[model samples]
Target: MEITILKSVIIDDCTTHRTVLKRLIENHPDLVLEGSYRNGIEAKNNGCEKNADLIFLDVEMPFIDGFDLLESFKKRPQVIMVSGKPDHALRAFEYDVTDYLLKPVSPKRFDMAIKKVQRNTGTMTGQSEDEHIFVRSNFRKVRVDYGDIKWVEALGDYVKLITEKKNILVLTSMKAFEQKLPENRFLRIHKSYIINLDRIENFTSTEVQVCGKQMPLSRKRKSRLLDALGAG
Candidate 1:
């Protein structure tokens, strides 16, 4: 059988830890490092295309944390946690990570994780396509569908999820809300705004009109947002 080619992204803060993880991933003949990021914000801010197969995510970073990074993408990639701290394993599971690797990871263990990743590719197919997601709101699990999500706006320590009929300002980070959305349907038009593509009526270079509400579209995101809407 031909060795399956894998594209990977590495995000971590510590230089030593990133170097170790890079060496480990490089040792595997089947895994290829697509990019390495020193921070979670840089990784997510860069955006994910359709082909990113896996992400070696760090649990902690400067502006945005690992879990937040995972949550920011509408299309969730198969993420293997790489952290110096072991206690973050439970938290990793909470974000539904594919695997957990503690710092100073051995090359052998890294190869093993790649093997597991290779074998599980079938199950990983379209894993993020499922639309319904449960978010903890008011100490209860609330079910929200992709269609119900109007837009996501950032707050100090939370994100405001405005639905068609109601608005929920959850006590969570923007990164957390980012992870819950479907990539094909949601577009982060600005650092402070992620709009549901399906809900938009029209848009301009500077703003998007969603449900009769005009929201500014960041200059950087204008093209991608248009492409996502099939307008470009």
Candidate 2:
């Protein structure tokens, strides 16, 4: 199999930070540094993000902030946010960002983030994830078909997978469980719930119905859900 080289870009206000990021990206075998811009406007104007697969974006900028830059994206790409403070990590995760890194990023941490990007991009190759995935249920491994799954709900440190015939509780975090499912078919619609897009019966701005059960939808994720549904 041919390795997919991810074309990458860096948008940091500090020249030193941008340079450091460029070096790190260049050192990676699976990544290609397409452009390194000093700011969001610079990146946009230079057309650096076209056909780019990844972005290393600084959270704090003068004019267009990191989240604002994310909002302006023509198409969502894997974003690894760089920030000086940890205050934005939770919100950045809400955006479904690949990873958040503090300034003066270590080589080990950079590689870890790259691994996450690889995982995300690799799962997105096919049109659908109509395959079965196994889960640990009741001290035994059980296979669950993708079509059979309706939704997943968080329970403290664990997640419950709701399927047509039965529910299986797995010892995993929502974020970890979400990564196991294909992004095209399953999405984290709320902080506590991930729903199979194919199983959605109806959805308003506030909630979605799956398998005859209504689940709360985060207002922040409503637009993303609509986009996933290809709603016009």
lDDT (Cα, tens digit) per residue for candidate 2, span 63-178: 88989988888887888888877667556655677777887888876875676576557632333344789899789999898767889999997899989899899999999889
Off by over 4 Å in 1: 48-50, 122-232
Clashes of 1: 4
Candidate 1, after superposition: displacement of residue 222 in Å? 50
Instruction: Show the colliding residue pairs in model 1.
Output: 71-178, 71-179, 72-179, 74-183
Which regions of candidate 2 deviate over 4 angstroms?
123-232
TM-score, candidate number 1: 0.50
Score every model by TM-score: 0.50, 0.58
lDDT of 2 at 35: 83
Clashes of 2: 0
Native-referenced Cα lDDT, model 2: 0.80
Question: What value does the lDDT take at residue 230 in candidate 1?
Answer: 28
